[model samples]
Target: MRAVRLSVVTATAAVAALTAVTGCTEKSSSGSGDRVVEVTATDDKCEVSKKEFPAGHVELAIENKGSKVTEVYVLFPDDRIVTERENIGPGTKQRVTAEVKAGDYQIACKPGMKGDGIRQNVKATGGTVAKRDPRLDKAVASYRAYVQAQADETLPLAETFAAAVKAGDLEAAKKAYAPSRIGWERTEPVAESFGDIDPKVDVRADGLEDGQEFTGWHRLEKALWQDKKIGAAEKTLADQLIADLKDWQKRVGKAEITPTSMANGAKELLDEVATGKVTGEEERYSHTDLVDFKANVEGAEKSYALLKPVAKENDAALVTELDQQFAALNTLLDKYRADKTSYDFTSYDKVGEADRKELSDGVNALAEPLSKLAAAVVAK
Candidate 1:
C-alpha cells in the first residue's frame, strides 16, 4: 500500500481553539534572557500562546484543561531529539525545560489523533531556561499503562481473527477483523512488528465485502466468505489458506516476541515498584531488542526489494536465499527470547546480561550485511 502523508488540518483547528481560550499573546523570546512558554490542551485542540522562543534554555508550562488524556511533544528538525509529556490528564499541568538551539522547531500535540493534531512554529531568540515539568513522571506512567492495555487487547484479537477463519464464518470473521486491527492500528509505535505482511492485504482488505479478490491468505478467506459450497475446491482453498496463515503467524509471532517480550519484562519491572525490587537492571535489553528488530527489518526490506523481480521471474536461487535469510533471523530471534526469559531476574543480580549481549551482537551482525545485500539487490 502507498504511504499516506499526515495531515495538519485537524492540528490547525486545535490550535485555533487553544488560542481563543488561553487569550495568550505571542511574543519574541529572541533576546538574551530566559523565556516562559505556556501551552494548554482543550477538548478539540491544543493551543500555545506563542510560536517562537529565543535560542536558549526555554521552559514550557503545559496545562491540561481538556477532558481526555493529552501529551505535548517538542520536535527538533532531526526527529531524534524529542521531549514529550504524556497523559497530562484533565485539569493537570506540567512543565519541561529544553535547551533550544537556533534552528527550525515545532510544538506538536495529539500526534496520532485524527482531528486533534496541532503544531506551531517556534523561533527561539537567545539564551534558554532550564525548568522541568513536574507532571512528566505521571505522564510517563500513564503512557506506559496505555501501551500495555493496547498490547493486551491486540493479541487476543489476532487469535480471534484466526478462529473466525477456522470456523468458516465470513460474516463473523469480517466483524472480528476490524476489532483485531484496531489493536494494531492504535498501537502505531509497534506497527512495524508485523514485518512484510502488506497492510493492503492483511488489515485493509482482508475481510472486506469488496468484489476484488487479491492473492495469498486473504484470497482464501474471500473464497470461504463468498463461495457457498463446501466442496473439494473450497477445502483445497481452505487448506492453502491455513498453511499461509501458519506461515504468516510465524513471521508475525516472531516480530511480536522480541518487542512484546521486552515490553512485558519492562512492565514486570514497573509492577515491581511496589516491592522496590528492580531486578535485571543491566540485564533488561528493551533498547537492544528494538535496535536488533529494526536491523532485521531493514535487512528484510532490502532483501525483498532485491528479490522481488527475481522472484517474479521464477528465480529459485533468489527466493531460496531470501527464505534462508528470513529463517535465520527468525531462529535468532526465537533463541534470544528463550534466553531472555530463562533466567529469573529476581533471583540473580546479573540476570540475562550474557544472553542479551549475545543477542545484541547477533542482531547488529545480521543488520549490517543484510542491509548491504538488500540495497545491492534493490539497486540491481
Candidate 2:
C-alpha cells in the first residue's frame, strides 16, 4: 500500500468556547474560618459566576444542572489532588469538599467526552477571586501560530530529501531522509482519506552501489548518486522515486487530521525506517518528514502549554507531575537526535540493552500524564 502522510487537525470554535467559560469561585461561608464556593456544570459546559478564590481550606459545591451525564474536577498544581463526581444527571447536584490552596487553578468537566470541553481559570486572591488574565489569551495564540509555521515548512524539506538522494551523498541523504519520513508519517491520518495505493512495481532491486546491492529508499539514493555512469538505469530509479512522492502527497491530503494521529503515524514511520522495511522503486527521502516530526513535537508543546496556564491558575498539585512528563519527552527527542542510529531496532544491542530499556521506560512514563491531558481536552 502507498504510505500515508500525517497532518494536524485544528480545534473548532465551539470547543474553544466550552473551555473558556468554566470558572472557579471562593467565597466567605457562614462559618468563621473557611470559605464556600459553588460550581455548576451544564450538559454543554461548566460555569462559576466568580472566577477567583482564596487560598485556604475551602468547600466546593459542584452542581450538575444540565441533561447529559457530566462530571466536575478540580485539578491542583501538583496533580496530587483531583476531586471528581461521576454520572450526575440533569438537574442533579453533587457536593465535593476539598481543601484548596491559594493560587491559580483549572475547573474541568466531562473528563473523557468529546466536543466543547469545559475549562476555566481560577485565581485565588487573599480569600477573594479574580478575573482571567489577558496574557493567557495571547499565549494561546502564540502557540497556535508557532505550530502552523512548522507545518508550512514540510514541503521544502521533502524537496531537499529528493535532491540529496539525487546527489548521491549518503551522509546528506541520511539527514534528508529523516525529515521527509517524519513529514509523511505525521501527516498519515489525513493521508488515509485518499485510501490505499499499492507500491509501484517498476521500482526494482537490481542496482548496485560500491559493489553492494541496495534496498529501501536510502539504498536507492546511494546507488543513483554514487553511480558514475548516468544511463537508463539511473533515469528509471529517479522516475520511480518521483512517482512514490506523488502518491504520498495524494493520499496525505485526504485523510482525517488530528495531532495524536499524526504523532502516532510519525512514530510508525520511524519504526519502519529503523526496521528497514520501507521498500519500493519510487522512494526518495523528502524533507516533509522532518516537518511532520516537528508538527508532532508542536502537538506535544500545545499539550504542555495548555497545562502551564492550568497549573498557574489552579495550583493543581499535579503541575510538577505534568511538567516532568513533558520534560521526559524533550529528553527523548534530544537523545534521538544525539544518536539517530540508536532507534535502529536491528542494532539495539549495539546501544546496549540497558540504554534501550531506559528509552522504553521514559516513553512509558509519559503515558499517564498524556492520557490525563488528552482526557481533559477531549472531555470538553
Candidate 3:
C-alpha cells in the first residue's frame, strides 16, 4: 500500500510532521527501562532533558510547548526518522519507549507541521538492544485477518459495480466504482498473486504494451466518464472484471502474507498514489484520484499497524515515528473526507499546481519513513 526513503534535502523540502523527539501512549514491546527522558517542543525548538543515555529501553515524553501544531521525531545519522508523533495541538502530549545501540542520533521537530523542524543530537552509550518480540507472529496474523476482511468486503461490491456497468447504468456504475476498488486496493498484494488477473484488471495505460487491448478499470472508466456511455464491449469487460476479482478473492484466501511482503505491499500502494493519483492519471475522467488515494492509505495504514507491536519491541522510536507519520498523512487525506466514507475533493485537473505539489510532498514525507517499516518489524 507504500515505500519511501527521504534524504536530508528531501525532508527539508517537504517538511510536515516527522522524525524523533516525541512521546506517546504505547509501551515498548521490550520491558520498561530505567531511562526516562522528557522532551518539550516549541514552534522552533526541540529541547531534550538529557542528550546522553545508556540506551536500553528509553522512555520519552514529548510535549508540545508551542502555540501552533507540532510534531517530534528521532532520526538516524542518515536523517531517516527513527520515531515520531504528530499533531500535538497547542498543549497536547505524546510518549514513546525505544531500545537502541551506542550511536549518534538526531531529534527533529516540525512546527506547524511544516518543513523539517529543528534537529538535535542524542547519544546512546550502550550497545544494541537484542531483538526478541513475542508479538511478531501475532502481527503477521493480524495483517492476514485485515486482508481477509478487505477481500470479503470486495466480493459483493465488485458484483454490484460490475452489474451496474453491464446494465449500461453509467450513473450507478460510477457510484459503485470507488467502493469496489477499495477492497482491491487494500488487498492488492494477495489479489495480485494471480499472475494474469492483476495485470489484466489493475494495469494502467502506462503499462499497456503496444497492440495490447486496454481493459479493466481504466478501460471501463473511459466508457462511463469520458464517453458518457457504455456499449456491448464495455459491458462484457465489466463481467470479466467481476470474474477476475472473484478469482482473486478465492486464490488470495489461501495465500500466506509475511511481515516483509505485507510491509512492502503497503509501501507499493503509496507509490501508486504518488506516481498516479497525485499526477491526476488514475480515474482521469472522473477526477476521483483522491478516492484511490484514500483507499491506498487505508491499506498501508493497516499493514503498518499489523507490524507495529514488534517494531516497537526492537525500535520503539521507529514505531512511534511511523504512528505519527501515518496519523499526519491520514489527517492530510482526511481533509478530502466529505462524509463518513467519501472525499470532497475535485479532480486534479481542477486543483492548482501548488496544491498538487503540496500533496506530492506530503506523500513523499510519509513514504520515507514507511519504507523502513518492513525491516524494522522483521528484524531478529
**Could you estimate the TM-score for every candidate?**
0.32, 0.39, 0.63
- Expressed as tens digits, the lDDT of each residue in 1-380 for candidate 2 is 12211111132433344345544233333343335567677665566646665664344566776767665555443221234334456776654443344676556666233332366666665843333244434544554444344334545665675566566555675556555444444333233323222223111243221233333344454454444333445445544555655665544333333322222232332333221222212233221222233334445545356435544444444456766765775566555344543322222223445654564465446533443432222121
TM-score of 2: 0.39
lDDT (10s digit) by residue, model 3, range 1-380: 21111224443432333344343122232323446667777876677777777755555677888898776666666554444445567798765545456777666666775554676667888766555364766776777777778878887988898999988898999988877788778666555533346656776665554455677887888888889999999999998887777777776656645565676667767767887789887777878888788888888888887777777787888778778877877777766666645555555577788878878988888887776776676555
**Higher lDDT: candidate 1 or 3?**
3
Best by TM-score: 3
TM-score of 1: 0.32
lDDT of 1 at 121: 58
lDDT of 3 at 279: 85
RMSD of 2: 16.0
TM-score of 3: 0.63
Residue 6, candidate 1: how far off, in angstroms?
Answer: 6.2
Question: By TM-score, highest first, what's the ranking?
Answer: 3, 2, 1
Ranking by lDDT: 3, 2, 1
lDDT of every predicted structure (CA atoms): 0.42, 0.43, 0.69
Worst 10 residues of 3 by lDDT: 1-10
Best by lDDT: 3
